[model samples]
Target: MITKYLAILRMKYVEMFAYQLSTMVWMFGTMVQPLITMMVWMNIYPDQGESFVLYFVALIMVERLTSAWDVWEMDRQIREGTFSYQIVRPFHPIHWAIAENIVYKGLFLVVLVPCWIILALFIPSLRLHLSVTGWGLFLAALLLGAVIRFAMSFLFGILCFWMNKVTAIYAMFETVSLFLSGQIAPFSLLPPVVKQISTFFPYRYMIGFPLEILTGTANSHTLMIGFIGSFIWAVVLIVIISLLWNAGLKKNQAVGG
Candidate 1:
């Protein structure tokens, strides 16, 4: 079973790489979001402290680097009423999504690192304390975040089956996440309500928690708690998706063999 999944996952990469122009667009200016955020925020916090810059610069890059809203694709498949195709297939629909995620991020990360170095040079206020231990912890947390994020997306996508215009809900959630997930600023700087509530929200787990740990702000104990929280969220989300998909499969209105 695992081997079959591995094979399918490999083919997803080949398919993604076939689109050269799209791949180029993804790599070149995808970093623009961070650049804009950095410029605006740097103007706001020009001399607060170097730590903020270090973390803020890394925050923009990390947020941009980790960004994915697979819900759109999920909603598309369901709206086109083609989700039945995946249901009849021998493998989980999520397997393909996972493969797609790996391929896109892996390919882009190749180019992103060199760009990170260049950005670090240009932005004197930017500082990153990259160490072996920090990198290892960050990678582990990142992988966990990916799983949780994907499951959340899968859930949002499935919601379209029961509700009209659920995309609006997802968009609203995206707006909240941008602020709460440390994508705009450190979670530390947020209001007590924002910070307190963010910990309960999955977006903070998906981005801000890992960002703080990577930059050495959350500390070991808090980082452990964050990772555990994220892992548990991923598990719960997967379970929810399984139950919903089972129900959805029974109601599938699309044709299939």
Candidate 2:
């Protein structure tokens, strides 16, 4: 099983490498939004402490690592009947999406790491207060964040089995995520009501909570709350995805087979 997954990862890496230029272009596109947000915030809140820079830089990294565009791919496959090939495979189709997610991010990091180093060096104010323990916790939170984000996206993609237009559904998800996931701004900088509301949803855990840990903005209590919230959301999302996948499979078999 492990070997199969590794093969899938390698296959994805090779495919992505074959179109490295396009991959790099997409990486730049991803960077643009966060870079613009960082610049705007820096100018608007020039007096804000070093934490501001650290937070946004961490936000950029988290955004790059945790992003999942598999929904679009899955939607295309389902719509085009390409997904039928996966249905007959021994493994679940979702594994392909998961492998693609890992490969895409790993490849993008080859470019992202140097860019990050340059940003950190050129920007004197962007200081990270990272401890050994914090690094461990931050990685754990990041993994959980990635899983939650992937599950949410895959679940939405499964909607393609029933709906003819999944793009609008995905757009709505992205629209809400932009405001609630701290992609627009740090949760701390949001209005009080918005901040409180963000905490209640899984969106913050998807990106901002991990960024808070990485930037040393989250205290012990906040970290504990984040971990608990993230775990709950992860489990809930997993269950939801499983149920949706089964339902979608049945629907697909009924309609297409």
Candidate 3:
């Protein structure tokens, strides 16, 4: 399995760089929304402009690292009957999606880390003062965030077997996540009720939890709740995906055969 993953990673890396222009375009393009959001927050609280700058820049990094587009891919593939090919393959189709995410996110970190260091040199606010343990926790939370996002996407993607509007459904989920997942503003700035509500949903665990860890804003209690929330959601999503995968495959076979 490790050997197969390594080979898939290599193939995905080559495939990603094959469209160098598009990859570059996408990498830079994703920054626009976060940058714009940063500007808005800066304007809202001019006194805390520096803080807003750091938050949104980190937001861009976290967002790109955790973003998943499997729903769109699976939607088109299943709709076009191309997914049937993957279904018959020796390897599970989910592994291919996971490999693609690993390759793309690894590329993102390589590009973004340097850009962050460069920016930090000029913008003191971008500098992060984190201990070894803090960094480790942040990375772990980030990985969990990525898994939650990927699992959610794959769950919605598998729904394409039964529903033509899985992409639309997933879009709705993403739209809601923008507010709940801290894309619109820092979760701290949200109303008390909203913050409480967000805790119950996986949206906050997907992006907000890692950003909280990275920014060093989470208290011990908050950290405890965040990890617990993330773990529960991760387990729940995995269970759902496993159940659905079998049902989806059976449905696909019946329809295609």
Per-residue C-alpha lDDT of model 3 across residues 127-204, encoded as one tens digit per residue: 999899999989989999999999999999999888889888888999999989999999889988988899999999
Global lDDT of each candidate = 0.75, 0.84, 0.91
Tens digits of per-residue lDDT for model 2 on 97-190?
8999988888767777787778778787565658899899999999999999999888888888898888788888888988999999887789
- In model 2, where is the ten-residue run with the lowest total lDDT? 248-257
TM for every model, in the order presented, reads 0.87, 0.93, 0.97
lDDT of 2 at 131: 86
Clashes of 2: 0
Worst 10 residues of 1 by lDDT: 248-257
Arranged by lDDT with the best first, the candidates are 3, 2, 1
Write down the lDDT that model 1 would get. 0.75
Winner on TM-score (1 vs 2): 2
Residue pairs with colliding backbones in model 1 are none
Question: Residue 132's C-alpha lDDT in candidate 3?
Answer: 99
